[model samples]
Target: MKEAILAAIKAYDTIILHRHVRPDPDAYGSQMGLATIIQASFPEKQVFSVGNDEASLRFLGKVDEIADELYQDALVIVCDTANTARISDRRYTAGKMLIKIDHHPNDEPYGDLVWVDTSASSCSEMIVSFYETFQEELTLHEEAARLLYAGIVGDTGRFMYPSTTSETFRLTAKLVHFPFDRPALYRHLYEQSLPMTRLAGYILEHFQMEEGGAATVFLPEELLTRFEVDPREASGLVNVIDSAVGLKAWIMFIQEGDVIRARLRSKGPVINELAKEYGGGGHPLASGATIHTLEEMAEMKRKLIAICLETV
Candidate 1:
């Protein structure tokens, strides 16, 4: 599959990259990191990464605003996005060919050339492996290194998650060889604003725990308004209560417009199954779902509690 993707890259003169909507570090890291590599290696080819600009991730790199005609004959490659609905840009299908590179479950595979590696720590790690596989033909610079490293770190929780395998560390070791400011990257990725800090404090103070080891916190839009934080920014605090005693799994429900988004995390129980029941799916230990109403959110909490109890 890597050989096939490489051949596709070599065949195209104009290549466009994409990631998931409401982008995270991994999404930006993989999309732009691969773009940087291709642009550096093939200076003559027209390469662009298209997506909405995420303010928090602006430190990594900015996205491009190319003409729609660019996709007329372009090779579109999406990274870190699992399903079609989650893809940031709808123009991904306007290209001549489409490639999917992701680390999520291949539940809704939608590409001409799909490459899904759930075992890989992040899509950025897979990008590094791709570069390493054909180092002679590919060029990776400091910027690409920084982006890929950030993706791996974000998805792995700074190597704290179980997804961090021996290969993850081995590839990460290679990324550090480039001359990038690792400390600054850490600061940019983790430094929280005062409002976000207060929001985290609020979450830590108010999250509830069930007898079956299911922890949950619901952040209504009004509470977010009180904290002056965006719904996307509040999602970052899902792990604020992860270390709480007797917690087997946790869910952070943040209201975004009309739908309530659920960020689910578990230590042992399989929660992605629950996520799927509610129109979301991700890793077993980490997943997400959507709720339409407060009543639905309560029902999800009951199901998660049952799952945790079964695991125990």
Candidate 2:
């Protein structure tokens, strides 16, 4: 798959990169890191990273303005997105050739060439490994290494999550050979504003646990307005319940306008299947879903509780 993707890259004069919507560190990291490597390798080719406007992690790379016509003869490389709907820019299909590079489990493989490595800790890690595959011919500098390392660290939860592996550490070790401020990266990724901190406090006080160790944090429309912070930003507060002993699973619902976006996590159960039931799918341990109405939210909450209890 890497060779096929490389062939496509060599064939195209213009290459475009993309990631999922509501970009996370891993999303931006893989997108930017690959773009940097490609630009470094083929300085003659024109490469652009396109997606929904860059948000929180734009510091990794500035989102570029791209004309739709440019994609007519381009090779679109989508990183970290599981499916087409999750893609930030739908223009990917318009490209002359499409490539999918991701670590998430593939459901509906959309690309002309697909490379999905579920064992890879993160897409950035996969990108690093991809570079290592062609090391004799390609060069990885600080710009690519730092962003890829940040993606690896972010997705692995600083090596605390179950996804962290020996290869994850080894890949990261290779990146450190390049010069970048690791401490500053942490500050940028983990540090939060005062309002967001207060929002975390609110979640702590408000989240409730049900029978059989299922926990939930629901941010209704009003509370979201009260907080004056994007509900997506508050999504990280779901970590507050990670220390809960005996908890099988947890879900936090953040109201995003018409739909309630769920960030679901599990210590034991396979919840990505459940996420698929609720209109989303991601990794088995960490996944997300979108609920249409209050009724669906209640329905999903009950179903998650059942999963926790092993009653369903």
Candidate 3:
């Protein structure tokens, strides 16, 4: 797979990178990290990262905008994304050749060269493993290392998640050897504004914790303006319920336009399979889905609670 991906990289002079919509740190990190490493390793290649901006995350890396004509002969690499519906820029199909490098379960194969590693902790981890195969040809620098490390940390929950394998630690050990400031990277990743802190308090106060060890959170669209935050930031609100002593599973449902987007997390149970019941799926411990109404979110919550109870 590495040979095939590297061959595609060498075959095409222009390359465009993309990830899922409403970008998370892992998405941005994997997309930007790959582009950075590729550009540095193959200096002659034109590599670009494309997506919309989350103002709160621009401190990490700037989003790139390119002309549509460039895709005519370009190689597109979609990272950290599961399916086409979730891709930020639909124009990826315009590329001359396509590759899918993802850590998500292989539900659909959309690329000419597809490499999906479900065992990897994150897509960034997979990229590190990819470059390690041809270490002599590729150069790993501080900028790329910092971005990749951030992605691994974000997706692994700072080495606490079950997916954080020994290989994850080994790759991360070498990643931190680079010149970037690890402390500064962490500050940027975890620090929140005062309003965001207060909103987290609100989320905890309104949580619907069931005796069955499941918890549910509901935040209406109107709360976004009240909190003066981008709707994208609401996903972090789910973290408030993560550390509760007896909580086995939790879900955050934020009303976004016509759909209620759910962010689900579990301490022991396999919840991604439940996420699959709706139109979404992800890692076993962390997942997401979307439903049409708050009532549907309630129904999903009840079903999820039942599943959590069984796990207990």
Candidate 4:
């Protein structure tokens, strides 16, 4: 599969990269990391990474603004996004060929060449592996290393999550050898604003822990307004209560416009099934879902509580 992807890259003169919507570190990491590598290695090719700019992740790299006509005869590669609906830009299909590289479950599987490795820590990790496969033909410099490193660290929770394997650490060790500033990258990826800090305090204080080891917090629009934090920013605090004792799993529900977004995390139980029931899916330990109403959110809580109970 890596050989085929490499062949595709070599064959195309114009390549466009994309990732999931409402981007995270991993999304930008894999998409732009691969782009940087290709751009450096093949200076003649027109490479572009397109998506709505994620403000918090701009420290790693900025996205390119390319004309839609560029997709003509272009090779489009999407990273970290599992399903077609979650892809950021609609122009992904406009290219001559479509490739999907992701670390999530391959349920939807909507590309001409699909490579989904759930065991991999993040899509960025897979990108590193791709470069390693063709080291002689590919170029991986400081910027590519920094972006891919950030993705692996973010998805693995700074190597705290269970997804981090021996290979993850080994590849991460290689990434750190680059000249990029690790301390600055860490600061950029994790630093919170004052309002976000206040919101975290509120979540820590008010989050409820159920008897079945299911912890939950509901951040309605009103509460978000009180803290003056954007709903998108509040998603970062989903793991604020992860260290709470006896917590088998946790869910953070943040109101976003007419829909409520649920970020689910687990220590043991598989919660992606629950996420799937609500029209969302991701890793078993970490998944996300959307709720249309407060009643639906309550039902989701009940279902999560039941899942935790079963695991216990």
Mark the 10 consecutive residues where model 3 has the least summed lDDT.
Answer: 229-238
* Per-model root-mean-square deviation over C-alphas: 0.8, 1.6, 1.2, 0.9
Give lDDT: candidate 2, residue 65: 85
TM-score of each: 0.99, 0.96, 0.97, 0.98
Q: Please give the distance, in angstroms, between residue 11's alpha carbon in candidate 3 and its true position after superposition.
A: 1.1
lDDT of 1 by residue, 1-312 (tens): 999999999999999999999899999999999999999999999999999989889999999999999999999999999899999989999999999999999988888999999999999999999999999999999999999999999999999999999999999999999989999999999999999999999999999999699999999999999999999889999998988889999999999999999999999999999999998988999999888998999999999999988996
Q: Backbone clashes in each candidate structure, one number apiece? A: 0, 0, 0, 0
Clashes of 2: 0
> Best by lDDT, which number?
1
| Cα lDDT tens digits for candidate 2, 198-299 | 888888888888988889989987887788888777787778778877778999999988989999998888899999897788888889988889888888
Cα deviation at 87, candidate 1, in Å, is: 0.5
Candidate 3 lDDT, 32-86, residue by residue in tens: 9999999999999899999887776787799888899999999999999988888
**Model 1: lDDT to the true structure:** 0.95
What 10-residue stretch in candidate 4 is worst by lDDT? Answer: 303-312
Give the residue spans of candidate 4 off by over 4 A.
Answer: none
Stretches of candidate 2 exceeding 4 Å from the true structure: none
